[model samples]
Target: MNINKIKNSKNNFKLIVITAYDALFAKLFEKESHMILVGDSLNMSFAGKPDTLSATLDQMIYHTNAVCTGAPSAFVICDMPFGSYINKDEALRNCIEVYSKTQAAAVKIEGGEDRADIIKHLTSNSIAVMGHIGLMPQYVRSEGGYLVRGKTAEDIEQLVKDAKAIEAAGAFSIVLEGVKTQAAREVTQAVNIPVIGIGAGNVTDGQVLVWSDMLGFFEDFKPKFVKRYLMGGEAVRKAVKQYAQEVQNGIFPSKEEEY
Candidate 1:
């Protein structure tokens, strides 16, 4: 989907967003999801890392390229990994590199009011941006942990301001993550752009979840927000076990199976 379609979907439709790290799932999600994010969460899900901080720009670009290759008609977003956009010039340079190296339709940056200027610079330079606020993973260490936001009136007000600022800075949309349901609804109303939520409730314009979490491939821990749609790991285990049993019994190569 393009920016206009995404913006128009704000009050009309519930946008579906899913994070994909490779071409296989990207293709599977393309027809159904409005957008596919090549998220830095890949560090945690794919590399078994503690957090997303260590994901680099090159890594993001590599995954973005794969997603784009798999879903040529899809709107793909590449995450601007932590430390890649510390300043306006650096942000612009890095974002430009992303545009040049991959087919990502936009870049998702984690921050809000504090990063408005950098967002403005990148947008002014013709780089599309999707703003991320509320419990930003990139700030997990500095913030002490992944905490829910918009619990109080003051917190809700700050969140509204952040949404407005990001929108004002030309972000086509925003991802409001790990927030109180009511507070997330308020933030979504305060902004003109679409607000995609995660652990932020169904009141927002849309919702996003990591593919593995939703599909039940990630069994280490289930977040409160994730609703497992399929027991992928269990199915895989069962299928493999059956195959092993058949092989051990010498039942795989019958006369009809001979080439």
Candidate 2:
């Protein structure tokens, strides 16, 4: 699907975005979700890392390729991992490789005003970009952990400015994460491009959540913004336990089943 469908549906439809790191999940949710992000959260969710700082470009490409292969018709966006895009040249090179190798529709880069130029460069080169602002996980260590942003006047002002800058830089959409509700609302109103919220607020044009978090598959920790739809992890554990019990009781290969 064309990424513009999301950009153009600003007030028409509430876009749905979900994170996926592999082919099976991508295929399963392809029809229900408007977009699938190969988010760097995989560093924590899939790789058992403490933070997103360790996610690599190669890992992102491998996962993005899998998602793209499974959901060919779904719009997929891959995150440009930490240290992969610190400058115009580096950003362009990595983004090009990601787009060329994975066939994802776009790449999401973390940062705000500082990334405007890089966003422009990528867009100009025919590579779509999705901007990420507020509580960037890649900067968690430097920022002193995952604090909610835009709590002060100065913070709100900069957020609005960043949103405008990202829109002007030709990003098709931006992810507003862990920002104050009022500030998130203002940013959504300030940008023509779609704003997808995570912990930001319901005022955004769309919403995104980590797949495992929402499905209760990743039980390591639960963020405040996530809403669990199913106790997937618990269910899996129960199923495994039941299988072991049945095996111990010699319940398998009954008389009617000799092959």
Candidate 3:
């Protein structure tokens, strides 16, 4: 679906968004996912990095291009990494670079009322932006780890305010992450545009998850929010072990496989 359709989907069918870093998985996920995000979470899931803070704009653009190449018809949003949107002018310039270099329909920026000016600048320049709020991965270090938000009345009020500000800044949608369930529901109701959740609960307009986490490719400790649908890592290991056994036993290069 396009941006307009996704925006209009508020209170309608729940949108399905998933992260994809390469062409193969992007194509596989295109049919099921309404939107594919070239998320900076790739730094951890694909690049084996400890956090998302070190992910670069160039890396994001590269993966976005690969995803677009694989799923040409699918709407793709590339993530603007940690330091890429520090200010208005720099944010616009980087966003323009993304637009120029890849087929990404939009770029996601993590922030709220504090980053409204930057979001406004990008949208003003005709760069589509998706807003991200609550438990920002980029703020992990500064905020002292991934803490769930919206526990208090003041926090919930501030979340509503943040959603409104981001909407006012012209973001088509927002990705709300790691918040208390009731708080997520309130924020979703407060916003007219679609609110996509990740670990924030199901009351929102949509949901997103890293492909690796959902598919069970990542064998690391699973988060409470993640529900693995396939034990991909274990299956791969099992198949590889069989293959190794076959090769060692001289049974792999059978008559049927000969050139």
User: Considering every candidate listed, which one attains the maximal lDDT?
Assistant: 3
In model 2, the runs with Cα more than 4 Å from the true position are: 253-258
Q: What would the TM-scores of all predictions be?
A: 0.97, 0.97, 0.99
| lDDT agreement with native, every candidate | 0.94, 0.92, 0.95
Number of clashes found in candidate 1:
0
Number of clashes recorded per candidate: 0, 0, 0
lDDT of 3 by residue, 4-38 (tens): 99998997799999999999999999999999999
**Candidate 1: how large is its RMSD?**
1.2
lDDT of 1 by residue, 33-69 (tens): 9999999999998989989999999999999999999
- For candidate 1, give the lDDT of residue 49: 93
